[model samples]
Target: MSPTRSHDGLDIGVSFEFFPPKTEKMEETLWASIKRLAPLSPRFVSVTYGAGGSTRERTHNTVARMLRETPLKPAAHLTCVDASREEVDDVISDYWMIGVRHIVALRGDPANGVGQRYQPHPEGYASTPELIEGIRKIGDFEVSVSAYPEKHPESPDVVADIELLKRKVDAGATRAITQFFFDNDVFERYVERVRKAGIDIPIVPGLVPVVNFSQTAQFARRAGASVPAWIVKRFEGLEDDVETRKLVAAAVAAEQAFDLVDRGFRDFHFYTMNRADLVFAICHLLGLRAKPEEVAKATAAA
Candidate 1:
């Protein structure tokens, strides 16, 4: 059977991605977001570690707490960065012990951060495919890796990017989740290329709701995603009005999401950025309803 699903867009599935909190207040906010979104019954939620294994301990504590207290399945993000094979293996084993059965395996940005030349540790897995191989050897993890709709910044071209993805597939990646894109046609084209390469794993679209337009544009620039001029025009001059910006953000996100559904996409992964209201509103616009029992479990987990 396919590890995730054959996303012909017939059956809907949504997943959320969250980062480990850096402060107690942030932690409270994260759990509250989880509680709010839980009733939508996401396929799974994922917790991310920072570049170079930073936030490692907090990530573990959060995922472990989820397993103990929530009905949601948490996918821990693991990276090949600044850590030896043994160290990475130990972390994977710990996740297994805590019942984390899924992982978002990645070749993380260089320790210095993005835009620098990526350097693999002398004793670390060299790339994402090797990371996936290592993860699978340690346990039967439902692994997901990143895909770039706009070719990765360092990749010479889209062909090379897709080639690397095929390697991840051969190395046992269960599915591919993309970076957020403002243009749906871009995602569709990327998927077509991936399919032509003979990779059938579900390529789930990642959506990021715009909380602040200028900030989102900056992030997109760094991540190799383009913010279309139309999007810029929509958020134009709302800089001072936070409330109005939010309304615009919701309308833009909703339009993007509903358009994808019309284009026949069932599986989605949201980069929640630790805020729930905008994403929740968009999902509700997509016609998803909350589940009562799941909501109770989320409250208890919180």
Candidate 2:
């Protein structure tokens, strides 16, 4: 049997990723997405920080609100980019004070943009490994780091990518979340390589429901993830058909999640892009259910 096949009765746990909104409209959309997905009993939810700490205040405030208002455990993304060690440390301390125990540590991209030279701040943590170490020193955070299934664009090869992950694990990353990929084989092969390296961290596959194929295509190019030619063909000429596109998006994502679950991956991290209906439908198809507490709350609200 393929390793991907589901084993005995293990419950699948899901988590979601949302970016901090920059406008009131976006804020409304973000909260709508959160509330829509909240009833599914995700293991946690995360708010992403922008490149070079651009969303620092918003990220902190959003995460703080989640702690105060929601049952979801909020993981805040922290990066060592364009900031001093002291500045980064202050941010970490702020998160800790707000009762956050999880962080996604990253060596952020250049503020100028991708393909530009990356220069670490002389006083800040350099790479993700260094960031992980710094986080561990400050608090017992359940630190998760990024993994590139197709290998980081800056990496010379897959071997180098695996080695980098090992270094982060050694430095105290509790888990690894991969960049989104359409091909499950990429994830499967990456996991195989990760296990062979003797690093036993849970590598959760990140799922992006392709609501807008063109936007996702552009993003995949920027992030160095490949969008298979066949996938484009699947959504070909549907640009003007928003409803049909959404239906297709849900079906594709649902199939991918079901296949992963069958393969024994019980954890998934969805990149929601602040859209709720599609991701919510996909999670429902994955057998996720609201706990009684959440259902009661939803019922009361209704």
Candidate 3:
């Protein structure tokens, strides 16, 4: 992908992903980060469901709170792992009743954990496409499904991955958020392939600001994302330097976002890891700012 110098006065769309907090202190931190990023007016924010639907209640509570207390649209993540159809349908109904119109449907990892073979419950929706269809039947939800630019770990090839995405789109998924990747060319090529396969939904690239390089690298390996050699070199010798690591993280993320923008991508999804500092810095670099007027209006409404 050749980068273009078209950085002057561009408006872009962004969405954020957050995981439900597991404790009171983490809850406080999550809320603080949400309040900070809320002012920038993301297109939508999503809260993740834990593996095997373990954090179902926590995820629901977080989404409900966002709906009630903030002026932001929240997308609840629903997974088809160890859940019966009726149970998952009930969750979908509950979200609909609470005014949630968007859902991120996923085929969650095996209940045993990552790297384990995923076995769908006997009475559950077997895949993400089935989950999307179930949500549509429950209500008119704007569903989003997962995409893997480098191909899902379990997928045999890119063709199989795109076929799955096509099924989800046909089942009513309107958007696909990809797994985070370090290489822009890989994403660009994936986008082209998705389009050529007749899947027209938005394939938003997911960006992760490396809060902890080692941890992020581990996650990348598990999720089938490649960690470019250059990224490893960038974080080299900063093992104990917290402040400088953060600075490098912000710079690297900013460069990636800007390069994607130059390639004509106007929408992005950020995996925030429940923190806002690095994401906020990258958003600023992408020309997104918190409009004071909008903030004041939201505050007054609250």
Candidate 4:
């Protein structure tokens, strides 16, 4: 039996992603989510770098605070967009200095925002693979890069996306957290293609529990992932009913996660839109219960 099955659902690993807060109220909410999820013992909790690196300072501060206040390991997202090589390297070295050893490196969306064309700074790391190389050069950071199960919007084909992933792994990425997809079949097929290409690093399936169906559809569209019709139907009548919607959203996300566990996926990464209740409930449904911090970390690392 696979380790995922043998573990009796207790030994699987999970991680979370949070974006830095922009306000005091948001900061309160963000820390609430962090503290709530901390007990589940995620392998690492990652904070996102906003498009074009707009949230660089906030990301750093949140990560630094996590390092100072929480026992949870934090991974800082680094991007090559508007910043030059020296600027980016200085940030990487700062992370190392602060004892953050995991980096999620990416070529961020265009500086202006989504839908804008991306142009690399002439003096910066030109691509994600190159950014990974720069990060590796600076420290023995455990670098993680993005993977797209539905294929990156900019890639001509899925094969090309896998080829770029191959380059990222060759450039020293230690893991790939996939862009969220609604369909498990899509993720399974993407993993097959990745392995066939000889990319053996962990391809963790990223899960986004729906806080709102319409909003989730928007995110999926931007990510080039399709929301299946059945998922659409599940939420069609719940728009005006917030309570029902939350319940249904929890059910849908839990079902997806449980199915993946059945399929032998041992690791999961959740995009926790700064909300913990939904993701926490889903994890609880998956046989995960909060333990003392040390035991939780040992279970996660198991």
Global lDDT scores for all candidate models: 0.89, 0.87, 0.90, 0.89
Clashing pairs in 1: none
- Residue by residue across 13-50, what tens digits does model 4's lDDT show? 78999999999999989988887888777789999986
Among residues 3 or more apart in sequence or in different chains, the pairs in candidate 4 whose N, CA or C atoms overlap within 3 Å are none
Among all windows of 10 consecutive residues in model 2, the one with the lowest summed lDDT is 1-10
User: Mind sharing the TM-score for model 1?
Assistant: 0.95
Off-target runs (Cα >4 Å) in candidate 1 are 1-10, 52-54
Candidate 2 off by > 4 Å: 1-8, 52-54, 298-302
Deviation from native of the Cα of residue 147 in model 2, angstroms: 0.4
TM-score, model 2 to reference = 0.94
Write the residue-wise lDDT of candidate 2 on 73-109 in tens digits. Answer: 8999998888888998899999999899999999989
User: What is candidate 3's lDDT per residue for 1-302, written digit by digit as tens?
Assistant: 01112246666888999999999999988987887788778899999996545499999999998988888899999999888999999999999999999999999999888899999999999999889989988898999999999999999999999999999999999999999999999999999999999999999999999989999999999999999999999999999999999999999999999899889998889999999999989988887878776577456544
- Specify the highest-lDDT model's number: 3
Give lDDT: candidate 1, residue 9: 33
Report the lDDT tens digits of candidate 1 across residue range 269-293: 9999999999999887777777777
Q: What is the TM-score of each candidate against the true structure?
A: 0.95, 0.94, 0.95, 0.94
Backbone clashes for every candidate come to 0, 5, 0, 0
Please give the lDDT score at residue 208 for candidate 2: 98
